[model samples]
Target: MEFDYTMTTIKPFDVAVLAVEEEIVKAGMRVLYVHDVQKSLVEKGFQRDQFKIVEFCNAKYANEFLNADIKIGLCMPCKINVYVKDGEAFISGMRPIVLSQFFPHADLGEMPKEIDQIIRNIIDNAK
Candidate 1:
């Protein structure tokens, strides 16, 4: 029943962020941009740990998957939340397969599985 996957690392939050980014690139994807959710929370008068979101994508994967069904574009650019908790850094995100099921295009060959595996591997390696 588990859908999202998360990994904890003794490394600091910034280090964990770099780890996730490195894994994504090693898999041949590009890290789109990082968002600091913690900063926004702090602006709201709430102190929080490092809570950033890292998004990445692979052009080759996207082109092929869209050929199968462009609707999959809605889920383009996989995202992972890089955060700190209890002095430990953690990366968490939904498995692409979990979201793919929402659309009928979930069974479009191995493309979905390919994307899922890449992102999952990124999270795992980040740990």
Candidate 2:
């Protein structure tokens, strides 16, 4: 199974990105970083435009999971990136289920479902 999923066909890339960020914050997650990719690339070495990545995380959830297994720091953080492609804004995130699979003995039984739903809600609201 794939770890990443994408939402396509969104209009006004900037608005869509903001909507997703709002939804994520409303769902009790913290916006850790919002990178304007175009500017970042230009700062680095690319000429791309209208691209951004929003990194988010819920402290409560992250702490709980981390306390359960310290080694899970390999995937300690979670993020969702919003970017433009073909003139449309799209959101993408890593599937928690796949990430959890990396630690089979960690007992992430209900956590994956909860995380997935939170991500889905953010994506749905973005649209």
Candidate 3:
């Protein structure tokens, strides 16, 4: 099975970042943090492609997963990344269904599929 979902666009990196943040909110999720990876690297005198990590979560989903298995917290607060590479901006996120493979004993039910669609929609909309 595919491990991730990604969309590429010619849009500027900054514009892509904003689009992702808005899309997360539009999906009824909260943005927990936006990590400016490029800036962090620049601070240490390294230059790199533009990159931002957008961390977000839907409280109900988070609670359900955690209550089912505390270990799910390791992947809590899904993340989408907007980054530039070879002159193209890309949006990518992990496929939630992969979690099932990682925790077969946990009763995640249909959540992974539900969340997978939501996350794919978020990335597609943003792109």
Over 4 Å off, model 2: none
**lDDT of each candidate versus the true structure:** 0.81, 0.79, 0.93
All candidates: CA RMSD in angstroms? 2.0, 1.7, 0.8
TM-score of 1: 0.85
Backbone clashes counted, model 1? 0
Instruction: Give one digit per residue, the lDDT tens place, for model 3 in 1-127.
Output: 8999999977788888898999999999999999999999999999999999999999999999999899999998899999988888899999999999999999999999999999999998888
Candidate 1 backbone collisions, by pair: none
Q: lDDT tens string, model 2, 32-73?
A: 888887997898888885777788888778887887788877
Candidate 1: misplaced stretches above 4 Å?
105-107
Which stretches of candidate 3 lie above 4 Å from their native place? none
Error of 2 at 111 (Å): 0.7
Can you give the TM-score per candidate against the true fold?
Answer: 0.85, 0.87, 0.97
TM-score, prediction 2: 0.87
Clashes of each: 0, 0, 0
lDDT of 2: 0.79
